[model samples]
Target: MPAGDSWLFEMKYDGYRAQAAIAGDQVRLYSRGGHDWTRQFGFVAPALATITKGTALIDGEICAIDQHGRSNFSLLKTSLDGRSPIVFFAFDLLEQNGEDVARLPQAERKARLEALLTDLPADSPVIYSQHVAGNGQQVFDAMKAGGFEGVIAKAPAARYYGGDRSTAWLKIKAVQRQEFVVIGWRPPEYGVDNVRGLFLATYEDGQLVFRGAVGTGFTDKMRREVHEVLQLILADGPLDVKGMPRAEARACRWVEPRLLAEVEYTEVTPDGLIRHPSFKGLREDKPARDVHLEVQDA
Candidate 1:
């Protein structure tokens, strides 16, 4: 695939990517990883019922936006009392009026989505994802200038390829630092009893990518915290990847990838790995997978 192509660009929202399917009065919300989040986000289902009649599959991010239009995931997680305003930034229409429209070109689907929301209330949970024609680079630049993570470029005429990581959808994220769980440890090539470095991995797009390991920036307290977590998951056995054991020694304790730390990095490698990443701190609000290497716009 080439670098830059004719594509529909949207802001890479900092929230869970969900597909909301409304059938008659029944609405089912599925996360990007295929998890049923219908119960967790009940507020959205009721709003979806009001706008959709027969059936509609809407692609969007379930985000909690503040007064300044900035997403607040931490606030969203804590204030689950059903009072916080959660908005669904509807970006695409997959199925409408009992017809499967995902096979149609993306431009057609987006047009349908836009027409559906044209007369709706602006403050409604559903908001049409904005796009500018013939200015992909400018859109990307504006997103970066606004301190956003990045942008995602989707082929305007592409079809919905479910459960498949295709280059048709390209994600460009802001270069930010984040820490990950030290799931396992790898030995040094030649050294004493000390291990070479810790293996860092995070879940993204339903898969785990080894974000390289961290040998430096380890404090005594950090090491102790990592060791304690590693000890617990070790008895269960080494963490499996693709049905095979991760490339780590038995002596190395395998920890559950639950811990969230902050790290800083400059760029992502050609293989979609983080480069020159350094530890920052623990982030209690974010999940391990959400901390994976940032996606870049192709």
Candidate 2:
């Protein structure tokens, strides 16, 4: 590949997408789909306001880094709840001084964002997302070697599209894992000893849609424990299944949508089902409404 001024790269943090918006003295922090999370985050919006003189909107992620200095999702909620240190990795400046900067080139926007956050306390939660020019393959290889999630590639000239995925900003992951709602289950096979597996789904537009079954990565003890929980929430049938391909649908028992699960998958199928999905564990910190899916590019 030819080296040029067109490409930029950033770290792919495994955390919650957050947007900090400030108007006058009022500030707000939002989760994906515009969910208000300001009160929970505590000081994110206010800190950003202190740096910028006027109204501003900052797009970023709320992450808790492990001892290795890499973002770790498993520690995010607990770290936040305990009022421990967290990092607000601000990547994009959407607006400043009531002026929209979404149309600005990526490099120009990042430069301005860097200048806005020139001085911050060493331990401040708010951090300006840093990027490197070119050397994507080398950086990605280093990420894999360092056991990092992945790296993101961006078109320096591309304009920002808030809350939307675009080719201009591409992400490639070395590991695949995310939270999903356990909507149902499949009982043990006629002669099988333990429960078969659980039916998992993710929300799209706040609507729960079936993803697939996760039967692997569970210990015998966990299988039995999860089975007991599903039994308690057993329901007549899937509550709001819009559709499912007959071939993919098997003998499964539908349960209420309450339990959340963290799953690891090799990829997301064309039909939006998770491929090679393995049950990591229960996601006690995440709510069912926050479950979602993203199919990686082939």
Candidate 3:
């Protein structure tokens, strides 16, 4: 995490990034990829509508909270099938009273967002994402100890760069996690499910490169569900990827690089492969082209 008084640290949620636009009684929700998901997240829209009587734009995450009140991505995937309730953790206010406030400093935006959510009921679906001006190390340690995802360190005086990745915001994870494009797959050796492992890839130097494979962290039901989706997007041949082994290439089934997979790994090898990687879930919030190995910037 960044060490300085000018930095603000907030809890990094393990959930889908979403934006809510409120215009009077009309509240529309959009995904990170700019897809309309108001219906998919019907449970959270009503709470957003109650935020302002005029108009406002809020940016936050839609997450499924576990029994311990921590955001859980696995639970979120299950909840997508209409199994459980979800919450919207509002973190920033982009537009207030129909006026664009994105150019405002990060600290100012967060303060306005908190104020907008202050009148929400105790059991409201939308909650403000609180942050600390400093003490990043202390917060990260506490989050790690509590089995939370991680912390996001942001420059308090920096403006919001919407739809653009910037150094003003940094993600510091307790565990290593990344989003990889699903390039290929391997059939289960001896199982009812069609998929056993996913061959992953990430963008490097403006080209797609073979990262590695992830076979673990899938439940029997999830395996079956994911296999169904993979079947429809089969490709005639693999996309030309740098460092693909010929032997493994002949053994795998290639697919269109439209699916994004969330993966957790212990570390990266010297040759640019992920170690001890496991599948977490499929991510639809982000475009596959944006999947790249994250690095800390100075």
Candidate 4:
């Protein structure tokens, strides 16, 4: 994170990036890729609709918060089964009252967003994503101690550039984590109908490249569910990945790289492999082709 009073730091959330479009009595929730997911996260609409009677557009994250008030990505899937509650943490106000606010500065947008959600009931699912101005190191230290994901430093004067990555926003992760495309898998040696590990890869310079396998961090149920999906999408030939070890290439049961998995790792090896990797869960909001090696800003 850059050290400056002009930078606004917000807690990086571990959840799906979503937008809420509220028009009169109608509220639609869209994914990061603009796919409508209102029905999937139905509980969000009522709380957001209560925010205004006119039209508004809000950018935020849909997260499953644990008992410690931490956003837990693993609980997101189980929440869909009605096991836990999910909420929307609105961070930016794109449009409000039929007025375009995308070009506004970060500070202005956040102020407007907070004001919009301030009147909501205490039990409301719509939340205002709070941020602290400056103190990059202090904020990072506090968040890391609290077991938070990371911090997003935003240029206070920067305007929101929808659908584009901007230099104005920088992310500093307390833990190294990102999404990877599942290229294939290794079947369990001793068990029937179980996967031993997942073969992962990411896009580099327009080509898919091998990243090594993640052998741990799977529950018995996850192994079963993932195995069922892998069976259906088996590829006729191996993926045209670069730098795959010969032994792994021979052992892999290649599959279409359409499945995306979120994984955490200790660090990236000099040879371009993730070390001490742990699987978090599968992510559907992002496409597999968009998965790439994320390098944090220094």
Question: If candidate 4 were superposed on the true structure by all CA atoms, what would the RMSD be?
Answer: 1.6
Cα TM-score per model: 0.69, 0.76, 0.95, 0.95
How would you order the candidates by lDDT, starting with the best? 4, 3, 2, 1
- Cα TM-score of candidate 4: 0.95
Please tell me which model should have the higher lDDT, number 3 or number 4: 4
Better of 1 and 2 by TM-score: 2
Highest lDDT: which candidate? 4
The runs of at least 3 residues in candidate 3 whose Cα sits more than 4 Å from the true structure, single-residue gaps closed, are: 80-83, 190-193, 296-298
Better of 1 and 3 by TM-score: 3
List, residue by residue over 138-179, the lDDT tens digit for candidate 1.
787888788776776788878876542466676666655545
Q: Write the per-residue lDDT of candidate 4 for residues 213-282, one digit (tens) a residue.
A: 9988999999989899899899999889998998998999999988888899999989899999998988
Clashes of 1: 11
- Displacement of residue 160 (Cα, Å) in model 1 is 1.7
| Candidate 1 stretches greater than 4 Å from native | 1-6, 82-84, 176-199, 202-209, 213-235, 240-252, 256-264, 268-295
lDDT of each: 0.67, 0.77, 0.86, 0.89
Model 1 CA lDDT for position 83: 54
